[model samples]
Target: MVMEDMELERLSAAMDGELDDEKLPRLLGGCRHDPALQESWYAFHVIGETLRDPQLPPVRLHSRIAQALKEEPTVLVPKSSVGSVPLDGATQRRWLAMAAAIAVVVLTTALLRPSLPANPVIAQNGQSTPASTENGVSDRDIQTFVALHRQGSPLSEFQTVDYTPQTIAQR
Candidate 1:
């Protein structure tokens, strides 16, 4: 004769054991037949199992210092096993390479520290010629350039075209 709401109330109270003795089995039996509540129970149990698995990483540690206190101590190495550390050929080569690398870095920094002025120095294309030819361009070269510029100039009043030069001897 118990209603559905009373059954649910019994189930909620059963978790903390506040339910009547006779109602406990009925509340459990009601949940078993309820698909939604049964699914919720399965999900809760799955979460519990996932949390209990040791292979899974711990999500939260309360404090690093407190957690570190629980860890086992590692023993120090015995002196009998330790010997005089000497460099072999490979170790010597590695040390040499490291020294070379450091030297290269220091030299590079010293060489490329930009001691020059920051103003951009631009060189003109035709500004400077070597001392050997410093008296400027040659005369014949200038004459040849003038002749070519005159000969094929479309902008000139007398335009350049296929024209024949007449000789006095042939006339």
Candidate 2:
């Protein structure tokens, strides 16, 4: 694959007078028999001609990007600092507290609901009874939530997962 890439690179570069005498024939020979490569060479020439003329119609960036993405561009954004991705100590403690409280409410409701019979009277106080949580949303969601929070924040060393469908309890 690398040899093929280098051959193509050399052929393209030869057109720009970038390749030396030793490489010219090999590049030419490789490009001559490859119909797809030859078409690429011709298209490159046409693009060059358009660039030199400058009066050619403007290319839509979105179309060009769509085509390039189909061809698989190699660009990738580098990850930032890796440390400090987890919530700070105080914030984690607070989250633990809220989770604990929510769990307590749910447990209390579970215990209290048993005695209320099949048609338990509705509480009209407008306060919600905590329901069973999430059918056990994966640990992965927690990781992603933290990652997304980091992504939205200015924390340079924080960025990772993405997630959905859960909220931290306040009480």
Candidate 3:
């Protein structure tokens, strides 16, 4: 068994073109007498050839596959019941009840939904006021708020200051 394994290893190395020249003659001699070694050599050559050219397959592979498929038993599947199955009286009534409940919920939601105002109201100082109206904030009020915000904001400190050669001479 060990000798057979060593022979297989040497045969594999030879197939890879890595075996010593001296051992090549002895390996070839063994392959002549040993049917298993001969099979291994043929298998290795076939594998190498297949790897070199993937488009071709073993000679009898297609025929063997066709024979295997022919020998296989045919499978018959039953038709699916799904929507074709008839529901019992109780089940039919339950389905009808569920459908009616869904319809009622949909209708109730559509009828009870609140209508939205044409113009959205803006809230200021806890009071709801229509924007761009007499009671709402005016342009002057907006400008005053913007000025106050700029004065109070920390970003106001980083404002760009104008510089001149006279200012630099003073510094």
Best by TM-score: 3
Ranking by TM-score: 3, 2, 1
List clashing residue pairs in candidate 1: none
Give the per-residue lDDT digits (tens) of candidate 1, residues 1-171. 567556545544554346665565555456545754544434433343333433333222111111222131223245555575655886567547546644554454334434322444332344422211111112222333444455445775145332111111112
C-alpha TM-score for every candidate: 0.22, 0.29, 0.30
Off by over 4 Å in 1: 1-4, 40-171
Query: What Cα-based lDDT does every candidate model obtain?
Result: 0.38, 0.42, 0.47
State residue 68's C-alpha deviation in candidate 3, in Å: 40
lDDT by residue (tens digit), candidate 2, 64-93: 222223233223334564553655786556
Count backbone clashes in candidate 2: 0
Cα lDDT for residue 115, candidate 3 = 32
Question: How would you encode candidate 3's per-residue C-alpha lDDT over 40-101 as one tens digit per residue?
Answer: 77666545543433223223222222222223322323365554656689666755755564
- Clashes per candidate (backbone, < 3 Å): 0, 0, 0
The lDDT, on a scale of 0 to 1, for candidate 1 is 0.38
> For residue 116, what is the lDDT in candidate 3?
21
- Give model 1's TM-score versus the native structure: 0.22
Question: Cα miss at 11, model 1 (Å)?
Answer: 1.6
